[model samples]
Target chain A: MTRARLGLGLLGLTAAALAAGCQDVGGTVALGVRDEAVYAREVHAVLEARCGTLDCHGDARRPLRIYAETGLRLRDELRGQPLTAEELGDNLRAIEAIDPGAAAEDHLLVRKPLAVAAGGQRHLGGELWATRTAAAPTCLVAFLGGRDDAAMADACAAARAEVSLPPP
Target chain B: MSRRTLAQVATLALAALLAAGCLGETPEEQAARALGPDTCGGGRRRGEDDDEGGPEHRCGQPCLFCHSASYNPGEKIFIMAGTVFTRPGDTVGVGGAEVALEDAAGHQVSVLTNSTGNFMLSRGSSLQQRGKGQVRVPFDLVYPVSVVVRKDGVERKMRSHIQREASCAVCHAAALSATSAGHVVLEGP
Candidate 1:
């Protein structure tokens, strides 16, 4: 009877180990899948909505350039630049929200604003004022008021819907 | 006598005649003879009979006059005229405020206020001889007998006093107390 009890205990341990391994595998698969189309759409929408209008982020005269043309190239520009932890966290949250499973989150929404943060009020006002444009509908004021979560989530859904990659 | 002696006698006689002519005239008579008639005229030369020129005085229309404190030369003390808002549905009519420069001896220099509630007090060209120093200027509100407003109705007679630039040290300090005050030291050193 003691030998039977030992066999049952070993089976239970093996089952628990298999369950933990399955969870790890699932997390890895979720992170590894690359949806390039979704990434591109998200990048485009963020640029259009936040950085494309004149006299705001779109104006080249501003110290920080948030125009759509340059904004799309943010990933390469911001690659090893040092950022404050608060800034890094804001960027990480934005990236994670847009690309849920992607390992490399390269987006202008995080990098451009972080770069312009040093210009203080003028740059902040310009970026906030640019949101009045119809094409780029998101305003920094709404984002500041905690209303950006739904807007960003909708943008993410729209991007995912446009993605054409087949299921693995 | 020799010919030279005879010539000297003739020169002495001429000198004596000239001396007699000079002694016969009075000082005023000589002066009258020197200066021609009509010396004082509407457009005559000096010392003439009709000479009208005396001393030049400031004659043009007076421009707006403003004055600053002597000690704190930058602070402009002016009477501010505006309707004062009283508490609880009352608007007081302030016709003008009396702004003055107070000396240590209890002397008050009164300044006039214009229609726009602006008054200027400065040393005139003749009064510039007084040394520059701070003067205390106090403002007194001139309340009208009755203040009538279309909506707010009438207000009671109210009197209030406001004091500004009372002490010399208020403006004489190294740093300026208010940004609106003009530069203490005038330009062109």
Candidate 2:
């Protein structure tokens, strides 16, 4: 074969190999489907406030590190810098990776912070949702359940409002 | 385990020395080890009410780093804390400055910086804790505090509300980065 033909043949083989490996580990995340916009608006802020501190999940040493403008950032980025789209994408992947095949109630992300009394596993971070009615937890529940754009947005607004108001 | 970074190694060494020094201490001695009264940031000891000395024991470090329940153990806990600097990238503290906080419940309270420019909002053991030129509400602070720092009539307000006030430097690092807005500064970066 000519040199150009040989190079094309090798490139085609590599592409085929990569494509073959891209199978669904979990049925939730479809191939090439990451609902970043919905997550950015509804879920990202919740994560940043709850888990994005450098002393917490935001630490670079964590396996599921959360990057945000408030605490942890991508390498070479200043703290005051904005959370870029790529960072949101990175956060989504990290969050989804915690048992992607599981349902929202069964997912590690939900089970970790959930209260022990609520049947959740032990989490050294303590119980974030003592009763599971808190805004952040419910917001995550909505998003991870199905990331329905409208439902997630409503849940997000409720969560933000709860954060704004003082305890009655 | 992987090699410890310089920061980690230095922290471990300091912790070891501190632990060794406190190994034989009594309960009362342990309680007195924390540097200040419940809320005032001016590095005063347990009985001290006046800002007579320089900055608190350690200047420029985040107040809550060692003031929380996790770190101080038997010592008092500081729910919100941080240091104010003279300028960005500068370690010189802005003494006598004011850190004003407006919580979500419309509770407006402010505190003056100690000689070392450290300010912490703590729930004192008693309601008698006080600071010069500032007033603190007796109730717990509502979250999402709006912060403004003023010195010499020149005020610099933080553009963002203090979302997570567990420690100012928790999100505000000594070095500016995408994660930290740097230390609370009176001036430039």
Candidate 3:
């Protein structure tokens, strides 16, 4: 009986440790997904289509401009460059125009086209991401955690939990 | 060494372990502490308001992302400091011009200029400089900041689309030429 109790205690300790390891309370988790790669695959095209306009990000006069001539070329260029190289630096800066630390707060993901109820802000250029839930995946919601922090954090937490498990 | 005794001990140990792992300051509280005081960027503390029934003087912690001189891959801090003037080409400061910055999230705060026309949108606390012209204040730089100045029934808004530049004097400098207006001026007298 004493031995069985000790074994159970050990199992509980392991579970507690695993739980603590999985929680990304302070954004400590690695999130397993590289935001830059995700930006390349899911985000870059949308930004080019919506924001890279004649007077907006594509324009040099504007503080926030996306100068890429073509979406296909832009993706190829940004993704191909080594991290240290200064290629597509301005585009990256536009992506992080708002808080880079919190995706939900990033202006690129939520500002313009998105409605007030969906956490979008007013932009002189006009709205980009219009709805939170549409027939197809609104690229903005997928990137900005689908509406708020709880959803985004859950995704991060899930990624971390999966990564924490020992490989079979 | 009964089965009941083993089960009770295991249950108590598990509960204790769970309690130890789960109890502590919330994430928001930890973010507040990590960023520093709630002066310009976080939630307002109890009794932070003045006796005259003024607005709470707290700001969000995210301002460090842009305004902080010291930054890393992790976090930052800022000194909510700026200046206000009578108008373009005027040397004298505009006392009592209400200077306010509204973020995209709709969080806003305002402060009055001193006799020098300098307004560091802070509470009574003096700003501590981190770099040249940089001070510590509760400012989150994530949302776009809109700088507005209202005085003598006249208001002036920034022509630039976004308030990315926190240091007002950097762009709205003292005039060096005829075409260049050294200071930010109110549209009306």
Best-fitting candidate, scored by DockQ: 2
Ranking by DockQ: 2, 3, 1
Number of the predicted model whose lDDT against the real structure is largest = 2
lDDT per residue, candidate 3, A58-123, as tens digits?
A: 445566555433211233333212222132454655555544555554444465556666676777
Residue-by-residue lDDT tens digits, candidate 1, B63-169: 11112222221234323211212121221111233334333234345432222222233433232212112122343322111111121333222111112222211
- Interface Cα RMSD for all candidates? 28.9, 7.7, 20.6
Q: Looking at candidate 2, what is the lDDT of residue B130?
A: 60
Predicted candidate 3 versus true structure: per-residue lDDT over B36-149, tens digit per residue: 333331122434343121121222123323334544232333345445656555544556778777766676666666554555533225434332222334545443455678
**What's model 3's lDDT at B33?**
50
Q: Give a tens-digit lDDT track for model 2, residues A25-76.
A: 6556522244788888777776776666565777777767888775677865
Model 1: per-residue lDDT, tens digit, A1-168? 699999999999999999988774544323213233333434434543344322243333443343232121233343223323333233334434443443221223432333244332233433322222222223222232234356654644443343222211
Give the lDDT of residue B178 in candidate 2.
55
The lDDT ranking, best first, is: 2, 3, 1
TM-score of 3: 0.32
| Alpha-carbon lDDT, every model | 0.31, 0.67, 0.47
Query: What lDDT does candidate 3 reach at residue B149?
Result: 81
**Runs in model 3 lying further than 4 Å from the true structure:** A1-168, B1-68, B71-78, B122-141, B176-182
Q: How does candidate 1 fare on TM-score?
A: 0.16
